[model samples]
Target chain A: MSEPEKALAARSLASCHDCALVVRLPAGRAHVAARCPRCGAKVHRRKVDSLARTWALVITAAMLYVPANIYPVMTVTSLGKSQSDTIMSGAIYLLQHGMWPLALVVFVASVLVPLLKLAALSGLLISVQRGSSWRPRDRTRLYRITEVVGPWSMVDIYVVTILMALVSLGQLASIEAGLGAVFFAGVVILTLLAAESFDPRLIWDRAEASHARS
Target chain B: MPEADGREHASPAVADAVIEERSRLSIVWVIPIVAVLVGTWLAYRAFTERGPLVTITFESAAGLEAGKTKVKYKDVEIGAVEQIDLSADLSGVVVQARLGREATRYLTENTRFWVVRAQVSAGRVSGLSTLFSGAYIGIDPSTEGRPQRHFQGLPVAPVVTSDVPGRLFTLRAKAGGSLEVGSPVYYRSADVGDVVASELDESGNHVTVKVFLRAPHDQRVRKNTRFWNVSGIDLRLSPEGLELDTVSLTSLLIGGAAFDTPKDQDPGGPVEEGAVFELYPNRRAMLQPKLTVKRPFLLHFEGSVGGLVDGAPVEFRGIQVGEVRNVRLEFDADTNKLRIPVLIELQPERIALNSGGAVVSIGMDEVRRNWDDLVARGMRAQLQSGNLLTGQLAIGLDFHPDAPPAKINWDAPIPELPTIPSPIEELKTGLSQFVKRLSEVPLEQVGNNLNKTLEQLERTLASANALIAPDSEAGSELRRLLRDLADAAQSIRLLADHLEQHPEDLIRGKGAE
Candidate 1:
């Protein structure tokens, strides 16, 4: 049976998110803060303000992304002359230098992956907010992909940091992190948290609501 | 809250998670808000980094391209070209450049812009390294000039910068020789500088060469410094023998300039920039000149000055104080006399009037006064062969102690100095006088006397021949004398034989040893 079809009859079971324990709640128990028998941790139907928190965090991440790609991530100084490159431009520089594979990896992690994660999170939020469940299973899979790939966008931040440390040669050559690197890192972390707060069962809730309406 | 909302949503509603019990806006919204602030800062920085725009016009845009070619000063890139187009006159290309913010402080009216290309000029080679990196515009901004945005480009790159230690000087020549732009300037056989530029003077009567004499070398230039054309081989066949003369072998082929400053206590300080100096035709000419020409005169002659050429010296007695400006043969129709008029330049400074080596200009009036006195003293100008083998004639001015008295004709059309016959003319006159005296003798009387003398001489010769005849009485007497001499010789030989045997006997008769 599909997940939504199975969730249709699940009003008596309470799953402990902390200890992974399954117990039966009293009949007609509603909105009760209960402790897991094994872990003694408070349990609820879903994460507190899961959709609202995810929405706020995703919007923040999307806003921060504007500056992340607009400004240069780091500056490279050689022979007393300095040149700064944005993430996209750095990727283009790599491509122009005949390192297409490295360029693609940077593009996917630094630019494309973040944008795709933001879009996927927004898609899931919109689908759940509309109480429309066209494909709950597919929607859940999209959220899973978004959560997994969200942290990879921080690759650019790590690259900048390592280059700054390893390439410091006093006046000969040095790499310094630019203001954009901070915002880009912030976007990555916020997006990861947004994906974390996003509730997959909200999608199934929509599916159940549609079934009930019919 | 979501569980309570969802449990309540079981009664009525669109069962999506909507927690209505709390404020709608979450604290997570500040992340996006902070990101917006950072974005605004980044946009401001991007806009502020750009500087003012400048436009430059060049003759050609051969290697320049928009956004690719950079404008550099001292190897530092300060701007980039943004646009290029043909100028309104279609005579050149105009380029617009956008400078970085830091470059704004250095833009000035005297900022010279030149495209750096690998160039080989007549005197210099530059920008070889630019061949790899490609051509770029180079700037030199002089601080003395005011600020400017628009500029006209340099046609040729200037080889020397103002910071380069050198002094510029102008050497004016009668004609432009083989001196090219990169020709060496030698001082005492050492190459010190190069000919940076050469052009005709405004009057176009002379060629003026611009030279950069580098420091230490430049200090060697004095106001009295003499420059000469160190070009061409000077091969002169003189009475001595064949001669080859040149300042240097390289100068003989490519041409060059050599300057020497006579050591003086003053040396007129160091030579000033743009100080004008005459370029002597050759090294010999430079050695002959002690001062510039201060006085000029025209002397007319009735005799031939065939070998006298331009630049020939006019010596007073044996000292050279002037030079021959020109020699021309002209006919005086009124007098029906062929007069050779010679123009000469006399530098009175060659003579130390005060014995202090002071170059005194005894004015033209003083010269005229001396001319009257010299005429009274029978001073005259003559053309003498300077080199007999080469037949080069130089003008000579000397005082003839016994010449006929002649007065200066002050009323003549041109200035007339009294003339005296040359030594050659005097010899010719003496010969002609002898011929006239010879012709003045009574030829008939002398012929009669000569005939009488010849008759007497013939009689004496006939008598001598008759006496010396083999059968004559004198011949017979000589033969008899010869026979007696042979008899006497025979007796003498017998006496000598007796003495040879009794030589000891004669010594003993004297002392019996």
Candidate 2:
């Protein structure tokens, strides 16, 4: 295995996020606020309060996931008969009706994807919060996966919107969005922000701090 | 050297970075708080908006889909059927349904549920729209009575819903006939209501028909109103003539009832809802004068009482005053004879005491005294032919001054009245006596004497024929004499003929020709 590289904080150097200008930081205090001389921008050694912000968003998204799966996402009325379907129930209904392929797609995109993303984000948060230096490489990979797949959970909300807009033929046949759609949308958007606000470099900072202490 | 110079130049311009402390709580925490508030609110609303689940037991689940059927009241949906299961006993299906939150207040014991389907009956056609829209459960909600979640569904839709403004009346009849749910109730040739139910009374002796009369028309019913079955054509062959009566063609097809207060009597007081009225079979029977007080009397007859029956009229001077209770044959042990005792009940109301032609109420003691006095004055009960064609008999009370004196048997259960033989009975007795006298003659001896006389007459005729034979000497003389007489008769006839002509000719003077 290659030798682990030394961190930039150990070299007493911090780069400006806006202008990429390297500046010498005041040593021995990583919490100090600094300004870049080249672009007049506030700079930090890591995203400002990355753990707390991502934790707040992830907690919110996790809270919203409950109602998203509990309540009905949409109600479809056709030929004087009406039916309401939640995400999991819609998948089950499709599967029962001999359309396993469509069921698989819906299950993976709407239910499984959001659930896995929350788990990955929460795992990354706990490991970073605990200051564990174990497998920092895999933790970064998990963060990337959560970021890339977080938006796909919005597939259910889009289906609901398109069906509601297109199927509004008065009383004969109509589609209506339910409260679940709002909560589900919140989960999708919050998870995306949680992934965005997460600092992957924090994964290495913990390892570097542990290594220097040892 | 370039890095060392740059660091020496940058070190002079670079200042220490400023550090500041901020609030521990981040504003991003608001997202989760808003989510908690919204999620809690959504859950609370969902919990509150859900209504109670009710189970209804029905005879069958026909036209009922597990989740498709909706329960509606007055055309507005109030609930939906959620699931269906077979009853434990397997006699019926139990339907579980979820009702709207507001429907909780009206789920009472009297709330009715029935399946609504297209129906065509004799008097009504309903729910035609259900044919295309499919069948659905119907509800007639009632807020009265105890709240109940379990219910027994009705097999058929009710004839009268509670929303209709009406009053109910009960009619007791001998038979149900064609009266059924939805049968019309008529007033003065117009349909005013419908028969809601026709059920047999618990005793099974008669039918109890419940009718609903619409408002305004319902007020027309009075205490003294007479209700009669106007079903089918009423053809009566009465003493007046052949009579035909009917209310309407609709009533003629489907059974119906009609009510009216007689013109001569008062309409009486307004009746309360569910007032019971006796249903008469016909208008004539309903119009019979109502009598409150009756006194029964028995009359023993020695002659046959063949035509007399229960309900036979008892008359006083050709006017009906009572009806026969029954005609019975009894063995009179005291007299050692079989006698027919006819029981009749007299209505005291029909008899008016004339004090200068004014009716006065007579007490029983006064009536007994008067009756005794009348019997002493030769009042007699006799059997009379009421209808010659029908051979129906009636009891006639009339004065018979020559009748032997008799007394009323007041010791009997029903006071016995004295009776005299009817005129027809006397005529029958006379004809039977005449037949007895005619039968006494010896008809066979008379026929034998007549036969002997005829044989003697035949022998005399044969002897006379032999004496007058054509070949005998006496016969020849008689023939010659007969010829001479013929010649004289011919000459006389010619002379008379000539004289007759000459007499007319002489008067006209033959010399003038």
Candidate 3:
């Protein structure tokens, strides 16, 4: 759902999905297409198939996660010798070399943060599917958190890109991204899309339905 | 209660839609499936690349541990110790190591494994860099040998490698002396190989050393090649000059062996592997064809043979014929005389003789036949000082013209050859005899002759004096004549004085010459 339509759902008023303008739908027995006067954009009460789209994107991101960690993100050649390390191993190499602070940062962004976002998204999906209202406020807060943190997972991808660009000393030392980097970046981008396609109004919709039933 | 947003009131048909109809299998599920498949492949690749396991038995696992110690081939780790277990006999440690797949081809029966660490032996210092890099099991692979998975660890590093292109030979010496494993073996004073192994012989009477001569050096080892221990400094001080011989400074520190095929003699042919050669004590000893056939003969010397020891050279006309085999003191109860029995070995080959233009040697029969004649001709053995400073004496055979008459005891068990006193002893005795003969000379008879001659001379002198006496008639006449002679001497003296006073007077006839 767009921002304007999301706030309009609780008050029984039709608001533009793109802009915050409220609009009245013409009375009709057939299909009615509501258009906002101010923004001239199609206004819907909720995003079309919001749950399915978000679920598909989230699943795709989860799928790509495997390859991202399995393959080496880039190869580093130094002094005519080339060495390739995976993300986990790269962090380990840094730690072994006594750069543990950088290793910790990499670990959190590449491993822990991504895994937590997936879990939080899964939890939110499950709660909405079951029509449960348990800790609805906290669940909404968690959704916001997952959205804000989703882009930061791309830090590892950025670091790899920068290293690839900067470390080009030809045979002396050159770093080129590997297959893992592609999959990992795909995961980050897909997760961001999944967060965007999710309709937050669905969270309130399930709680109200459960409250009315009780 | 149902329409919270109030934006849409769905038809009953739409509201009654089944959840399964609304939910559809997404296309994105294919990604997870592909991810699962690729992940499995990567895991399998990692698993298949690990190679076969082999067990190495070592006397002790010093600096070795399970999963930590590496099995390295040329300083690159090819495997690691996976488990350490006690041998069946519990006498040593057996380590199981998993080699990488890349090392499979090198697993051969003849491949050697040894622990490399800092080793300081009398022969050399090696593998010192391993001290910092940590100890590792070294692999020396042989490509031609049959494949094997089990190996026995070497106790020490192999000094001679198979790839070094060398031939192995056995050398027997009375003792190990200072030559050790890794001790350099020299050919013509150039280091060629090393003593690979040393062990006591089964009889324990001698030490058998296994030596390697690498490549072209192996070609240098002829059947007639001579090897000797050149461990310590060899110093010789002689009347001609001083000579010092050493192979190298390392040879002095660790004790090494050197070999050479003498230039003068034929080297015969290249020796085969496992050929047994004798290691002589020094260069001088090695140069001589090792005298294997020795004829023993006993000699009885009358004087002390204190300086004559076994191994002392026995020379015939200043040429070494053999060595003093044994020396003993015997008290002859029958003769009540001290007899010194000396046993010497004579090598007939060492006594060279010239026939026509070529050098020939006399046979043993000829020596025996001619021996009796030589004894009759005053040929005897004597002790001569070979080196006065060291008090070393050698048995010298020569014709002592003044030696006491004696016959060779051909009937004796040992074929005893009579010995004459040494020249020093002979000189001492001859001086003493000369002194005794002088003491027997008659001093009284000589004194009587001298007194008679003196009395006769005195009587003659008295008669002669009476003729000139002034009291007798003949004496007075003689006196008058003597006075006339004195008057003439006085006139001559006066004339010499007048001449001295005036040269013109003599020239003018001393007034009337």
Candidate 4:
């Protein structure tokens, strides 16, 4: 094996004596007999299924993003009357009230954050798949942002829930949850999952391989 | 060394195991999923629950705003304003509102919509809705059929007095400042109606007014209803003092309306649409100066005498009922006529009643009737005065049984009672007249008779003087007689002495011898 492979193999198959599990280097390669599956006892190589499992989750998250935007999430009724306002409409309503800053916050947290996170995660996944030679620093920064902003994307969902719970007027008026809620929830969950499943080590692996060639 | 390395590896493995155990559950996805679910539910609720849209128009939008103002019924909010835009003509504002489905049924064609706010007045009920929501649209529901789109503006306030059904009569009077529209028409001092409208006639001579009464009272206003203006205070004077009659304090503060219905004949004719009735102002008679004497001057006379004093009737022509108003001696300068001017007020109505005259009569006819009565009754004028308490007077008419029938010269002054002479002036005149009569008597002849009588008296005195004169012949005879008398006297004295001596000196003859 080349010197870099040797180093990679050693680092990828580190052993945990207590659990008999293998603490592998963060990479896409598969290995057998790496650890005891039941006890996580130390072994010789890392599990080969980690990369595939992560990629599958990212794919599932991508599929849910479409329906989330198209459907409405809340339905409001007053005095035997009903109307549906989408995310954009609600933001516009707030904006018209001279609450532009608040509207911008809602827009960013609910819409822009979720979409950006999804796109960034997808890009990271694709780059990892291609083994692209990219700046480690840029990639780390992107990853940090995704982690920090991922939680805030649920702001729209939280706001909707809180409003629905608070504005329930028994017979005179009421607000009901719509189909869009479920789809939006799906999008949030899937995007979080996609972010979690991304492999940062893939970037390092490409760097190391390029370094060897140099 | 092998054992030490094994231990070191074991330590690392133990630490790694502990870390893995601590991080068993990755809750990040759960949090986002839950949040997304809630957000989705709320979004669904927002879209499906809106209401209907409606619009209202107002002459001036004023304080109304798109989303702030609400349509209210009995203070319950029924709708919210959606948008406010000026109409194309710019004469008014078109307000778009969102009516809750439940509240839409309340909007009807005849429903009245008006803006409500605070108002100030001296005697008004105001600021009723300020305690609730600020300014709002007040809706008054109507019983008309189906709901319609258009709405009518309601008057800001209710009318203080309304005329729906009542007796309509016109009051004709010389228009004065006191007689005005909205003046109280009082019946027995109670408010019954008000002057609704007033207008001047085309000739500018008369002001016609329309009055309205409320409720069952309207039925009481008959065609012949007498309408009078109650503009000033009604006063009655008595020994006690002056009494003022007016409505209650509240009515006094706001003024009042009044009217009365007569009991006897149903003066009720068809409601005369524009009947101009007589307006007898309480002060009209007092305000008017005596201009032209239409009828004989109304003299109010009064007198107090013993019960048996003359209670004779004052006869114009002697129909029998005009009573004496008063009897006072008047010295007339024009004719130098000393006569009693008896003040008398005759009730033409009573005369008309006895004669059964119509409501209105021509001046010529009335004058002719009076003339005929004057000729037959032997025209005599008298005075009359009303009761002290009432201040009403009527002239009585009666026959002058003692005096011959006197012809009445219409233009000449009516004959009055002879004025009794004042004692002082009568005595002075009598004395002057007696002196003049004495002067006219034949005193010259009386003076001659007096002369003859003086002569006879002088002769008698002369005879008397001769009989007793001392220097005359009678005086000489007297002297001789005196001598004889002296001698006789001496002899008689001696005899009387001898007789006294002789107890009964015989008889007085002896003395004489």
Candidate 5:
């Protein structure tokens, strides 16, 4: 094996020690499958297609979001009469009725939180690609936040669902779910997948290697 | 030892590697995407859900719930309560409502809003008429005006007294009994309108009540409409019988307002807004001239005058023209006189019914010019009892064209009205005077005259007696002849005895043999 390969194998073996796997270095820089020598188990490495798959899913979700907002998310009918309202209108209605705090919470959960998570995840991804050596702790915290907040982005959608279900008044009044709900659901799922597909090991590897050199 | 050291070194690296990994996805794009969806949805809703916004101000917002109340037209829901807010002054609650897009066409500047609840009345009327119906805003649309933002609260319920439209007037009174907002209003004896609302004014001294009267009937209400509280039975002794006068059976139980337009005047201009009227009692004793006429003239009177009483209405012709002022008695120059003089003032307009005269002209072109002559020729003032059973007197004037004119001495007699004594009083005085004249005849002088008459009768009686008495004869002169005379006397006596015994024999002369 070449000296660099030996060093890489040694690092991989050391990292896998807790799992009962000792990696063996190959001679050249070509990709090779390594197994833990101590436990005779195959070591799993980050997938080569992970980032692309996540990017595809997130971009698809992003595209769907446009139509979701542009169309009404719910249709309400009362006594043979039909009407529709969107998120902003609903919030404003609540505010006008002296439900300000509730309105604020809904606004943040449905709009601001989702957007923040998206931006943060994107930033983390870009930094990871450029091999940035910035504050690793902060980036880790940011990732954690994105993952945690991703599911909550469905708050508006859930609210719509519940309202549509509860407010069905037969002929007197009724509520129907709309296209915006589907799009919002897509955003949540895609964001969650994006967060999951990210590889944290890559961050520590670079960080530790630089620390060793220093 | 070397492997252990390497493992420790790589552990830190593994942790760092995990942090460094990132997804290739550009998640930032999701924000705009979601925003666009929400925004588009909202815009569509805004375009489709069109409605008019109306703001109503309320003094108290005790039971109002935002997003719950609704605006209704003809009991059909047209919109919903969007929100509620405090007025800038914090003195009231301002409610904002949003009607459906189609409903916007119906909203106009005349729309009204009010709170409704159950009300109780002392007249034994109770219950919730509008319960389960919920509080609703009402609209009265005007075709000409644009939609307005601010609206006045019409807290009063719609009055449905009559079908015609007319100006509404309000009145206030100290309700002797309980009264309700929807009480009926009567004019003369006809039902004209109803009470719309009753509320205490700021001063709280009186309760202002709103009443509505319908069209042609409302026109009957003139400036001189006299309002009286006619809610109870009024007992009046009319000439016919004991009269029970009441507006209505229900009004007698509860209470209501009654007014009348004077017969003479063309119904005065429509009742002015916010006009206040006094409430007169239904009793005849309370029938005094309205304040408009009280200030001008004051007159006094005395005696048992025939034509006037407390309620004896003064009349110009046969029509009632004025009223009696007072009735009293006075003593002048040690002579007691029953005096009753009436103070009569004519209603200038009613006086126009009489003929025109230089001194009493009423500017009526249609009036006959010789009014004084007509009055002198046709009018006769007399005392007429209201009801014989009740003994209430009323002065009546009648046209007595054929009857001789009253001997009213303009120059010699007292200027006051002659005291016409009541029949009972006249009978009593005549009887007493007859007794006095009889008692004045001298009984003692009559007794003396009777004694003189008796003495003269006795003297005449004595003279007659002396003539009838027996007398002495020439006696003893002829004693010698006594024997012969005796013999003759004896013979005569025998004959006299014989004649007395037989009168028929004497006429025949048989005793002389």
Candidate 6:
């Protein structure tokens, strides 16, 4: 094998996730979990059960996404007239009110981004489980993008909370968050946890295992 | 041997991966389970909070807007309009609303719904806040009847709702006049209630006015309480004098009713809700003592009955004992004369007889015997002018001993009372006698004597003028005698002056000087 083909695992060395300490591993006791010598964090070749954990969180997020879109996220009462709007409907309302830029921003951050993150995580999970030798660099880049963009979906939730706090003028005007906001917040948090639980190194592991087989 | 030594040393540093068999369920799976449980709970709560849908039909959709109008009870919102549709027959608009689950128990058959708008009525202004907040559906719920999901809306809001602590009373009137819903009801001139409704019965005979009397004041209503419409000023010119009566200023504008027990009557036990009472036109009419046992008597009057009218007081010894009911001119063909028949209702209750042992109420049978005795004793009915200014007349019952004796005619439809000629009839006879005396005087002889007397006075004035002529001899003789008498008087005056001066000087009377 070439020098680049010599992998870190083949050398039996691991870096601690918490302290970043490099340590040589003990030999041939696969049933026992390893710990960092310096910081004593659990050590593994890849995140332990990364696919299964990510699958569980991503499934939860997907389930929550439905109610988030179906139910009203917030209700705005102005001059005694109350109106309730869901996420997609809110964005559409902004569009209808001659605010296309705001509509685009809301649509992308609140709706499109979370959905795309869920899809990308699920894809990464399946590909890793199938032991695919696909382009590992591009797949890792996708994971990086999903992890970075997943939190911005909270823009809708922030707007709802801020409006609820600020626009309380009693009988004249008020704002209240609805049940969908709770579910939406759950989805955003779940997706974030799912992305954190995912291990990009598993993609390279799949590639290496397939390459070793070839 | 050297490769084995190096491998063994490397194995000490290299850790083997552990294939730990753990529960397949991950901790992360708990999030989804919790989320699912929460979702199920939310769904269940939503399902439970959902109330039944109700439909209300209104005559006009004046203040209703689909999905915008809210249903309120005492200003607290309990529901919202969901949809509005035209009725199948196109008679009105049907509104569908969904209420909160808390309101389910109050949806009853007697529940009333009405639109509350800014209304300016004769009695007062209401719902002014609705002008700014827009109209809303008002509900008066009653849990007494069967559960209902449909209702017919009232065209106007009821003046008094069932929620108010009050008793509903019914008043029957010959005419409604100015009374209407929202009119005030007064107890002794104090406003204590409102007219909830005024409607004509199916037969259109009388008006049925439903009034609500608020608590405490409602308890004042008794079985014998009199209700009178004090809607306007009551001005009357009677023998008592010009009098004006009114309840209050509000009653003058919006119309109102007042109730009280007559002074002489007993205010019986408290009346239940919806007790019916007669509505008199005025307080005087209501205060007129009601005598249940009335005996009607007919009188044939020989004099003019022009000034008497129906309802004129029939007085015994100047005290009102009855009322005149009817008066008609009938041609008595058998007698070949015209007669005036007057029907009078006499209340025996007004006359109490002290029978030495106890005061006995006069019954009809007793009244018959009494009438026969009185008529034999020359008790007669006469028309007397009650008010000379108004020229109104009243039937006066008195003992006219000089009247021709007569007995009660029991054979007539109504017992006939003996009648005597009124004073005006006596004056007519006296006036006719004077006219006859004036006509019987000897006019020709009186005119001749007056002419002779006038001629004699003219002759005497002519002789007196002739005696006073200036050129006659008696005038010249009188002039000479006057001159001789003046001279003689002057001499006598001189002598008397001398004597007076001497005597006054001697008596120290200096007045002579």
Question: Which candidate achieves the best DockQ against the true structure?
Answer: 2
Q: Using TM-score as the measure, which candidate wins? A: 6
Ranking by DockQ: 2, 6, 1, 3, 5, 4
| Tens-digit lDDT string for candidate 1 (B1-513) | 475655444433212221123344566666567756766786787789888788999999998887567898778889888999999999999999998887776678867788988887544578776665567888876666788889898876764556568888898999768887767889989988777788998999999988888887888888778888887787765423467767777777678899886555345666578788888877766776467555666787666677778877778887777888888888889999788778887787786577477555666678678878987887877777677778777777888867778766655555655565566767878999999999999999999999999999999999999998999999999888898999899888976786687787665663455
B380-450 per-residue lDDT for model 5 (tens digits): 45555555676655555566676555433334323222223334445757887998887787778888998
lDDT of 2: 0.85
Task: Evaluate all candidate structures by whole-model CA lDDT and list the values in order.
Answer: 0.78, 0.85, 0.79, 0.58, 0.61, 0.85
**lDDT string, candidate 2, A1-214, tens digits:** 1223234433456677887877766656544467877787886777877888899899998998898888889888775566778889999999999999999999999988888988898899999989999999999988887888878888888989998999999867899998789889988999999999999998998888898678
Q: Across residues B94-208, which tens digit of lDDT does each residue of candidate 3 receive? A: 9899999988888899888888878987656787866654567888878778899999999888887676888999999987878888889987678898998889989999999
Q: Give lDDT: candidate 5, residue B477.
A: 39
Q: Give the distance in Å from residue A181's predicted Cα in candidate 3 to where it truly belongs.
A: 11
Alpha carbon deviation, residue A94, candidate 5 (Å): 18
Per-model TM against the reference = 0.65, 0.72, 0.67, 0.40, 0.48, 0.79
How well does candidate 1 reproduce the true complex, by DockQ?
A: 0.15
Query: How is the predicted docking of candidate 4 categorized under the CAPRI scheme?
Result: incorrect
Q: What is the C-alpha RMSD of each candidate to the true structure, in Å?
A: 10.3, 7.3, 9.8, 16.4, 14.4, 8.1
Stronger candidate by DockQ (1 vs 3) = 1
The 10-residue segment of model 6 chain A with minimum total lDDT is A1-10
Q: For residues B1-513, write the lDDT of model 2, one tens digit per residue.
A: 475575555455443344444566677778778878887897798789888889999999988887778888988888899999999999999999999999998899988888998898766789886765567889888899999999999888988888889999999999887887788999998999999899999999999999999999999999999888888888965423456988888888898989999888999999999999998887777888788888999998877888787887889999989989989888879999887889999897887656897657768789888889999999999999877876778889998989999988777888988999999998998998999998998988998999999999999998778769988777898899999999999999986887687877556665555
After superposition, which runs of candidate 3 have C-alpha atoms over 4 Å from their true positions?
A1-134, A143-214, B1-25, B57-69, B82-95, B118-132, B144-146, B236-243, B331-337, B352-370, B388-391, B400-405, B410-413, B434-513
Candidate 1 interface RMSD (Å): 9.3
